[model samples]
Target: METVIVLSRLQFAFTVMFHYIFPPLTIGWGSFSPIWKRVTTSPENRSLPPLPSSG
Candidate 1:
């Protein structure tokens, strides 16, 4: 009974810690993946406007 209780506590702690750590990582990845893709795909897509034609 004592070992079972300790094991259950350990399992609970592991799951809680996993949840705490993994969600933020996945959420961060999801949030940043798009930006990462864009930046990586087109490094020089940012173009300047045409300059005025001075005589």
Candidate 2:
């Protein structure tokens, strides 16, 4: 009985940690993937915007 309870608690903890880690990884990829595609697809002649000068 005690071993079953411990196993259940371990499974619950594993799921919670997985949920916490997976979303951020997917979200980051979703956001960056578009930028990555754009960079690769953009024309070579197109110039990037100039950086702002520090005052």
TM-scores for the candidates: 0.73, 0.74
TM-score of 2: 0.74
Instruction: Name every residue pair that clashes in candidate 2.
Output: none
lDDT of 1 by residue, 1-55 (tens): 9999999999999999999999999999788767756665575855533333337
lDDT of each: 0.77, 0.79
lDDT of 2 by residue, 1-55 (tens): 9999999999999999999999999999789767766765589825654333337
lDDT of 1 at 24: 99
**Model 2 per-residue lDDT at 10:** 100
